[model samples]
Target: MDRLTLRLPPDLVRRFDAAAAGRGGRSRFLRRLMEEAAQAPLPAPVAATPAGRTGKLTLRLAEADLALLEAEAAVLGLSRTQWSVALIRRRLQRRPQLTPPEAVAFIEVQRELRRIGVNINQIARAMNTAVLEGTVLDLEVAQLAAFGDEIRAHLTGLRAAFEGNLAYWSDGT
Candidate 1:
């Protein structure tokens, strides 16, 4: 479809938006209005549909707000009821909120991970310095370097466990 660019004063724009609202937004409303104008003079605004299955939810909002709602609903090929219901359901059914105990546990796990990270950084720095200085490695540092593969594997396992617990807690698993 071709786009039309027309400039209007702020007051006229506001009036145009108000007229288009609650009746399938600017494009559809304007189309209908133009057709009506060609045939005869314009009439009063269209009344809203009944609440139907859902209970009433009436609000007096700005014309632009109404137009935005109508446009969004139309984009999904949904009536206002379906669109609103879907939005409500999506917001209501997000991941479960953490309890106090769970929140504490989560923070503790994060702290432990940071502590482990700091230890790893210290080890790496000591190892790098020993290599650069051509100094003999300490017995403990030698053992740690020898068992690096096992240490890395254990850290990877810990990370997997953390992720699993996080998903379980967040998703109510």
Candidate 2:
């Protein structure tokens, strides 16, 4: 038999097979499975952004630029299609009045802070769960201290970037 075998969760397969067993004809169940398997995933296309108060901004990236995004998306365990949707969302929400350099720095700093905040929340949850479970480690307290340090570091970096010639874009446009 030129059958291509695949491994699926036994429980799920059992459920399907059981349901299919009640069918009068052998082809009915196999046909349903083939139909489901042959169907392609629904396309998740990027949403078109509406113009905001800022002037029109259009961007076209080279294939290599897209490759970089696809690579990053793969690393983050997200589909490239979903990653593009997120990128478009960020772009549309950006304050376009800011100059090019300011826009870049501002977005970077905001992302850094957001990441740090999320990390802090995760750490806090872990710490709380550990405590509830009566698990103690000498380094647990020290690790908890790092959350404040991370916040301070991000804020300091943002301040430094602001103080440096980063006030305006150097593109000299």
What TM-scores do the predictions have?
Answer: 0.30, 0.33
Taken over the whole model, the C-alpha lDDT of each candidate is 0.65, 0.64
In model 2, where is the ten-residue run with the lowest total lDDT?
164-173
Best by lDDT: 1
Candidate 2 structure quality by residue, lDDT tens digits, 25-65: 44578777777877978678977776673354445689998
Model 1: how far is 160 from its true place, Å? Answer: 8.4
Residue runs of model 2 more than 4 Å from their true location after superposition: 1-98, 132-136, 164-173
Q: What does the lDDT read for residue 134 in candidate 2?
A: 32
**Root-mean-square deviation of every model:** 16.2, 20.0
- Candidate 1 similarity to native, TM-score: 0.30
